[model samples]
Target chain A: MQEELFTSGRNIPNIDPYLDVWHWPIALYLFLGGLAAGILFFAALFYILGKDEVYPGAVKKATVIPPIALSVGLLALIYDLTHPLYAWQLYTTFRIESPMSWGAWVLLIVTPIAFLWTFSYYREAFGGIESKLKLFNKLKFLNTFEAWVIKNRMNMAYALIPLSLILGVYTGILLSAFNARPLWNNAILGPLFLVSGLSTGAAAIIIMSKSMKEKHLFGKIDLGLIIVELALIAHMIMGYYAGSQVQLEAVELLVGGEFTLIFFGVVVLLGLLLPAFLEVGEIMGIKIPVIIPALLVIIGGLVFRFVMVEAGQLTRYLY
Target chain B: MRYAMVIDTKKCVGCSDCVVACQTENNVPEGFCRDWITEVVSGSYPNLELELRSERCNHCEEAPCVRCCPTGASHVVEGGIVLVNASECIGCGACIASCPYDARFQHPDGHVDKCTFCHHRLKKGQLPACVSVCPTKCMYFGDLDDPNSEVSQLLKDRKYKTLAPEAGTKPHVFYLI
Candidate 1:
């Protein structure tokens, strides 16, 4: 509105209507972190419930992904920081109220646990290599901690379940913490992001799952997550439309404004709906290309982050 | 001491002397500013009322930027003046995104920067650069807690409105209509 105001005098004020601080790197980091967390949550949950025996490939792929994705996500975050060299300062001090602090600590804890979980698959490989090479057999290794970790893995799996959930939800809290941005200031964002992350994580697992049953199970799980995400997004938009003046201004960015096309097209349609349709067809015994839907869901997840982060910046209370 | 500013929009003449003087006094980088002015137009056609307002950081009592800063780089110092510690700033842009007034900006040298209410002058027991340089003498600045302070007297003598009170920032700056 200030941009439309007709003032006779020179407008010397620096009227910044929207934020330009965050970019694609932040979105990339959010998606990667959420995806990593989702994978670990599924793997740990199934392992604790004794369901992992039926889907060994899915469990293995899921365990390996969390650490790799988290490492790459952390790199993106560090790259986005203006003072990348001073990143150690984040770990030096902690702020209870800052969501960034929570995120840094959560990632620090989850990364090591996820990496250790992947080592379960390495035992077989190490055994095979030692059998072929007599030198490796003579080179004794410290097995006490590894044996203890293996023996208490079920307890560790239980601990990782909640940490993984926190990792997924913390990424959403990062945006929701900014009360100034109305698009992101909602209670539902935590659940919405959690579901989205899980959906994408399921899709990633589906691509790598060796058994047909495991692939089908993940496909169904992804479908459920997509449905919940759609409902949450609808609620988020409706709540904003019914909110105060500034909130309406924030919603205007999504409804029919600059972000309308991308939000509806990439995020809702291709990302959620089409994938849902394809997955349903697969469940009904109608042959659908597996890679097509999996890649679409992953791409859709990335686009969702891009739209929310970019459009959230465009919605502001001040001009 | 709760230092504050009261700008009288009725007396302002739209001259940008305050802006120039503030840049000079603070050595604000080129393409950046610590203080500036805004022109507001109300009504339509012949009944239009044009008002020139000197605008800067409100130095809010509950600054969202300070609350969101991960490293406490954006902080409130003596006199309740919210200032950024340049050395500690990570330039993560969290403060910039949290400010409802859009008062903060990332400097080219990689730190958040905004109006300090001329804290340097306050140390010398002098008025702020903008308040001192306004040709029309429309801006008033002083310790709001002191009964005899110019800002307190001006606030008591005139009716005023703060920008975006609904924002719940409790801004230290006021506008005398």
Candidate 2:
């Protein structure tokens, strides 16, 4: 085994054997974008479904936050790049084989779509010229046109739902491409990210909606989404446990290694459980307001990102 | 043309002469280094084996630092030497994070900095500072494309390997275990 290891022609002279260097930035981009994509996906879904009645004013008010978060998230990603100004080159020189390149394109497309969807909705409610015309203007020549053929505000927003979901899942899949990093190289990461994104996005929307007094629209959705998120978290944990020993050790690092405190305390208990408990209380006719739990969930979600990004890098790849 | 380095671990004495030479040759700032040596000590006190790797920019053919750079400051030179255009850098630390080997640093001036393989010296037909100063003759640098070059001959005659070849960076540096 020792001879094979040395004779494999895989060692670098005077260079420490380490995992791929691009892992840190790529991981960070995946985490932040996944969260943003997850939030936007849910927001767009609820809006297009006309389920705003369940959450009331909250959904409408909270709609603005996703784009803002996504934009900020993108900035952080670009900030991680050595040459941030060359970010636009991703579109110009697209590489089909590179997941980062794919992510760049997805972010580019989703960012604009999300912005337009939010803007159109805002214009409609606030009585902007474009919004008023869109809402009230009649096209005499286009009366015979099929309703589905014409682009409408709600239709535009509906278009974003699938794209946003892809963006969310793409984050996970991006990391999975790194077969070198045993911790990150898993088929389950994609779905795990998808589920986590939904939960985190829903939590962010709920909290932001409360601050904006759009609680009517945000309240019920928050509870439902939180419950769904908890289930997903459970499944992810179970899946992580059932994988290879290397993966299991990686999971243990999250659950019991250096990252245990943040993972268990902040992510699991405070982020997932407390919010879930609050949602249960609300559903059961208890008077417990969700603001506290919502805040905790958000903090937990962010900490979860921090922990995942940092912990994944801590372990040295032995193979 | 692909230029490369081959370092034999057996001859390295864990002395940091190469590190000092690289720093001095480049006028590298205090508290920041373009190249350094990392010592890995395994086993207990008595039976420990010390492995020393002199690390710098790998000047990878598919360098991620160049790909992730937002400013075009990080790039590959003619001889496949990865370099940073310090003047064009904005100190964003993107390269630092993107580098798998942690080879880059954001200098005090907020520019991305890393080993250039001493382009100026290479242009004048001289070896890199670290390669020229190694007392044990552990480090060798030459053009890989030229079969007559020392590095090419060594690569063909002996077993050598690169770090993280799976990354597809295609680093020019090789290690003889």
Candidate 3:
């Protein structure tokens, strides 16, 4: 029998795994990106599918989210990078195999399109607010572009739907492409994130909707998206359980190990199930406060991304 | 030519000489390492067996870090040694997440760092710092394509194993029992 070469005692230290490369900046970026994508997707879809009169100001308010959320998310992403000043390197070339490359291109394309889409709501953006300021008279050149935007607004909104969907899916794929982390490597992550994005997007719209019917429409859609998100969560766990030893370890980390409390207690109970219950109660003609479920859904969506991004890194194949 | 490494686990003393040598040679930042020793203990308490194994980047042919790199910073250079271009690295940590071995770490200066198989030494016709500094002569490095190379000769004679063969990354580093 050989003696222990280096016992974990006073002499030798145990090396902990390096699993915290990503932090809140990343989590915020993931949440905001998905939120922005979802908002634009539904706004464009509503513009194309439903009667314009049914939701007069819904699309315009929703359009506001993508530009603000995405710009902030991009800032968060850039700030999180080790080389914030050298971020231009990501745009210099495209690697079809790299998800980050796809993400960079998607963001670049979406930024201009989102800015254009915002112009479609020129009346909403600069309606009476612009005229009150002396600067509006100085910038009379904006009137021509605003008219053109209003004329082709429908066509522009239609073009935004697919781009929004791509952005939502790209957020998930960014993590999924890391095959080393089993928790983030599942193929279902793409749709799971897309559905979560839609749910949060719907919740955002519901919070800002002017009409009862518009609120109800987005509320019902959010409920459906929440159901799919929950189903995907279950599928993701089951798949991990039935997967390789490394994958099973990942599930253990989430289900019973370090991340157990947060994953189950916060993400599932507080974030998902509670909002779902409230949504169900509202559907059943109960006087459930719309803000309650809407807030819960948004909180849940953010927590879900936080837990996954942080806990997923804790599950390593080499440890 | 495909570069390779062969480490005889039986001969390792777990003194961390290779670790210190690599750090000194590569100037690896404090509190981080490009290579380290893992102590594996097995058998019942009364019939215990202990082994010390040196671990580092396997530099796989199907390197996931290289694949997941957005800017092609992590690349395979001459003799299949995996190296990183610190200037091009965005420090996004994508490579850090994609590395199955956990061999990569985020350098405080902001780029992902890992074992490079000592390309600088190889260019100078010298062994890697870890290989040259091992007191037990357990670590061997050379091109596997040359039949006369020590690495190929060792592989020809020893019945060996690899860490996480199921990973399917086809790592170039081999272990001799």
Return the TM-scores of chain A for each candidate in numbered order: 0.89, 0.75, 0.91
What number of clashing residue pairs does each candidate have, in the order they appear?
0, 22, 0
Sort by DockQ, best first: 3, 1, 2
Off by over 4 Å in 1: A1-17, A124-145
**What TM-score does prediction 1 earn?**
0.92
Q: lDDT tens string, model 2, A131-212?
A: 5576435654333332323346466567677877778777776655544345665676677677666666666666665343
Highest lDDT model number: 3
Please give, for residues A85-149, the per-residue lDDT of candidate 3 as tens digits. 66888988888889888889899988877877776675564577656765546888777877877
Off by over 4 Å in 3: A1-15, A125-128, A151-155
- In the order shown, the candidates' DockQ scores are 0.46, 0.09, 0.49
Q: Please give, for residues B2-93, the per-residue lDDT of candidate 2 as tens digits.
A: 88889887677757788789879988776666766655566776777756667667888888777755446677779888887766665544
| Candidate with more favorable, higher lDDT: 1 or 2 | 1
Give the Å shift of residue A183 in candidate 2.
5.3
Docking class of predicted structure 2: incorrect
TM-score ranking of the models: 3, 1, 2
lDDT of 3 at B109: 81
Each prediction's RMSD over C-alphas, in Å, is 3.1, 7.4, 2.8
